[model samples]
Structures are given as structure tokens and as C-alpha cells.
Target: MPAKTKEQKTAACMALAMKRGDLKKTPGTPAGDMAESMTEEQLVELCGSKVKKGG
Candidate 1:
């Protein structure tokens, strides 16, 4: 089996959380977590408005 990347692991964690109803969308907090300020900037810099194959 192929090793799971961090993105893949995070996706699986999110999926499991949703499956168990652990990831709820709080009305007051739009962040819904799933995001970090620094990481978001890094991702944007890396991807740069281009749609990659896997993304």
C-alpha cells in the first residue's frame, strides 16, 4: 500500500470526525478549524491560483 501523505491523513481524520459527528460547524466560529493562518498562506504561495492535478 502507498504511504499516506499529511494531506491524506488530515483528510482521513476529517472524514472520521465527520463520520462520528465530532466535526461540527459551530455557528459562531466560521473557522470550523480545518485551517491555520500560517499554513493557509503557505498553501496559497505553493499552489498560486493554479489547479493542480490532485488538488
Candidate 2:
């Protein structure tokens, strides 16, 4: 899925942050939030678009 809004971005950010940390859970974080979930190809495309725009 694509992150089309700030809410989606925050959800994806939290999920990724949790994935990288050792904590089982984080307060105020939505455990069931998967609105921004995406496949590898989608991620690459999204980041690739940002990289181009940042240049």
C-alpha cells in the first residue's frame, strides 16, 4: 500500500521503528495500523521517487 497521507506515513514510520527496536510495544502506537503496508517493489518505487525529487 502507498502512504497517501500524514496519518499513513506516521503509521508506517511507527511500524518500521518498532521493527527495528527491541520493544514489544510502544505507547500511543497503533498495533493494528497497517494502512501504509507495502511490498518491496512498492517501497523501492516510493523511495526512488523521493530520491529523485530531493535532488
Candidate 3:
């Protein structure tokens, strides 16, 4: 699925990273909450538009 909003992109990227062992999920925190607070630049820097944009 393509990701539209920053939240969706962040989620997709994070999921991919976790699946690839690039990132680890915290014990008791929602990844969405962390992604929500991230700056757009930071998000882009981390994921680099790897997540496809939705229509």
C-alpha cells in the first residue's frame, strides 16, 4: 500500500526497517506517537521517500 500522509509514510518506513532489522520497536511505546512528533525533514532524512506516495 502507498503511504500518503507523513504518519503513513513514517509507519510504512518504520515497519520496513523493523522487518529488515534496521530498527527495533520499543517495549511499551507506539511508533506512531514518535513519528507524529518528528519534523518533516527528519522523517524524509530517515526514510528518504522509500515509501510510495498515495494518490
Candidate 4:
């Protein structure tokens, strides 16, 4: 199932970001560059607010 909640959306986006190397791992932080600079639009684009039905 596609992500539906804010938490799920964020997790999905973070996973995608990691897979695409858009987000890096820092020694002390859970995320790197993308997290530090990511905008709301970027997150929404990465993980859509709603999943397309039967598509």
C-alpha cells in the first residue's frame, strides 16, 4: 500500500531520498544534505500527499 499518513509519507520520502543519494548519512545525524535543506514542496513531490487509486 502507498503511504497515507504524514509519518508514512516522510518515511517513504526519506527512503527514496536515500536510495537516490539525495540524502546522505552523517556521523551524528539521521540525515545529511537533503534533510538540512529540503523544502515542503520537495517532500510532497518526493512522496505524494495521496496515492493514485488503481493506477
TM-score of every prediction relative to native? 0.36, 0.41, 0.41, 0.42
lDDT of 3: 0.55
Window of ten residues with lowest summed lDDT in model 4: 25-34
Show where candidate 2 strays beyond 4 Å: 22-55
Clashes of each: 0, 0, 0, 0
TM-score of 3: 0.41
Q: Model 1 Cα displacement at 5 (Å)?
A: 1.1
Cα error, residue 39 of model 2, in Å, equals 7.5
Query: What lDDT tens digits, residue by residue, belong to model 3 across residues 1-55?
Result: 3345677666646744554457774533445444456554555455666545555
- Identify the runs in model 1 with alpha carbons over 4 angstroms from their true place: 1-3, 25-55
Query: Candidate 2 lDDT, tens digit per residue, 1-55?
Result: 3455555555555555455453354555552233234443543443333222221
Candidate 4 lDDT over 1-55, as tens digits, reads: 4545556566657745764667664533433444446564565565775654453
State which candidate has the highest TM-score: 4
Off by over 4 Å in 4: 25-46, 49-55
The candidate with the higher lDDT, 2 or 3, is: 3
Pairs that collide, model 3: none
Error of 3 at 10 (Å): 0.8
For residues 1-55, write the lDDT of model 1, one tens digit per residue.
Answer: 2213555444434434443466763333323343322244433333243323452
Compare candidates 1 and 2 on TM-score and give the better one. Answer: 2
> What's the C-alpha lDDT at position 10 in model 2?
54
